[model samples]
Target: MTTVPTSAPQRATAPPSEGGHRRRRSRRTRERPNWVAGLTSVVWLAIVIVPIYWIVITSFKTQSNYYAENPFAPPGEPTIANYRLVIESDFPQYFLNSVIATIGAVIPAVLVSFMAAYAIVRGRRSRLLRWTNSLFLMGLAIPLQATVIPIYLIIIQLGLYDTLLALILPSIAFAIPLSVLVLSNFIRDVPKELFDSMRIDGATERGMLWRLAFPLTRPAVVTVTVYNALQIWNGFLLPLILTQSPDKRTLPLALWSFQGQYSINVPAVLASVVLTTLPILILYVVGRRQLLSGLTVGFGK
Candidate 1:
């Protein structure tokens, strides 16, 4: 009685943009799965994981069990006999040799490459340094296989063959090229203002290099170290051609002990394989983040 019938309130409608967004989202929801990517990843994972699974399973089995059972089957009665065989067969000697060679190569390669990269980045105005950088790039094109003969000859001439030094020297040489490439790119991305400020604080070029370049490029250093360590650790060809004595054998060569012309100890061989790969696995797990960060640092630039 006091008022006329209240007018019906209008419901608010979504704007065109919001309506379009919902439609687009619905279309996206209907899109097909990325089968190619998923399939490719599955295939690649199988390729990597199958071998690792075989190796691990074989390592736990006895030699007779390995032959009697399906190759892919898990060990029904896992034993440490294969590992014991590996230990008894001079595996420790071989492991020591590998450690020596890897450390010897990686330390020198990283250090020398870091200095060279620092020079290349900071010495851009010098024509000689530019040419030197080109030379390092050229080194990348020279395959290790092509240089094998030369390296063998050089090692022979230097009286370094049949020694861990033979393995280390060539590993360092080959490792430096890639290390310099990675590190120089990282060094180039460092802020120029930091260098200027260091100079203003009476820092010598060398001082600035050690204090600034070294610290900043640590991730790259870790990357290079891990990369080179893996290379040296897994190196079969180098050890094969360079070393001769059984006592001086690296892990790769020592694996041959599990094989004979007429008979083979498959489980023992796989035990050795597992042992050889463990150190590298540990190294990667420990430094994975640094390695990835270092590798990606220059990509954004």
Candidate 2:
């Protein structure tokens, strides 16, 4: 007997509906420009930019024009006299002092912090290391103001007062806590497989650290270096309290010297401020991408 030909069963399909289209339209509406956010950004930008612009314009104006002209007005006849005066003064010496202090502090702080972070991350199983990490975290809560008195007394006792070393030493101490915190977090994000692979290849921990950790953590290194450099460069209070001589004055204190008892030279003072800030601005511009990357993203295998 001939059997009837068998046929495959047809699968059922839902009828096309407007639900997905409607959902997409709703999402599109929600994704439209947030006017509130845009307006807030514009307002904040104006507030920041206006003052910087004012400082620039004010620095170029002559003293007579500075007062004669409106505070916000552009300089009708700009002169370099303010900058010339700043240069003629001991600005170069103060600049050198700032440079010395910044370099002295940042190098030691970064080196110590890097080693500390490496130890903390690699030796997390050790209770001593764990406690040390806690100690660093506690450091973040201690304000500089609270410790200034003790620091002053210590500096005096050690004969470090009125010296650039005084400024450099304290800056390193303060910079280490934040540097360690940042670097340890970055180190922890490194993949465990890489460490294991290195170990299998007969690489010692120190070798792995030099070959692996340093290369991998470059962005974090740049970030902390620029950050600590900026802090030490612009530092005013430490130099003010710890130093005693005009010859030892940093840029911040030199700016203070521009103020006279009777009248303040606004243009000259702003010029010095601009000059002092330029180096920091240049440093940030150079390392900005790496700094931003280290802060925002983590490394992986």
Clashes of each: 0, 0
Per-residue C-alpha lDDT of model 1 across residues 112-210, encoded as one tens digit per residue: 999999988897578899888999999999988888898999999999989888898889889999999999988988899999999999999999889
| TM-score per candidate, chains pooled | 0.87, 0.90
**Candidate that scores best on TM-score:** 2
Candidate 2 lands at a TM-score of 0.90
Candidate 2 on 1-301: residue-level lDDT in tens? 9999988888889776799889989999998999999999999999999999999999999988988889999999989998998988988999999999999999999999999999999874888998999999999999898999999999999999889999999999999999999999888888989999999999999998889998899899999999899888888889999999999999888877776521468998888889999999998898899988877775432
Model 1 residue 238 CA deviation in Å:
1.8
Off by over 4 Å in 1: 1-33, 261-263, 298-301
Model 1: per-residue Cα lDDT at residue 191: 97
Clashing pairs in 1: none
lDDT score, candidate 1, position 187: 91
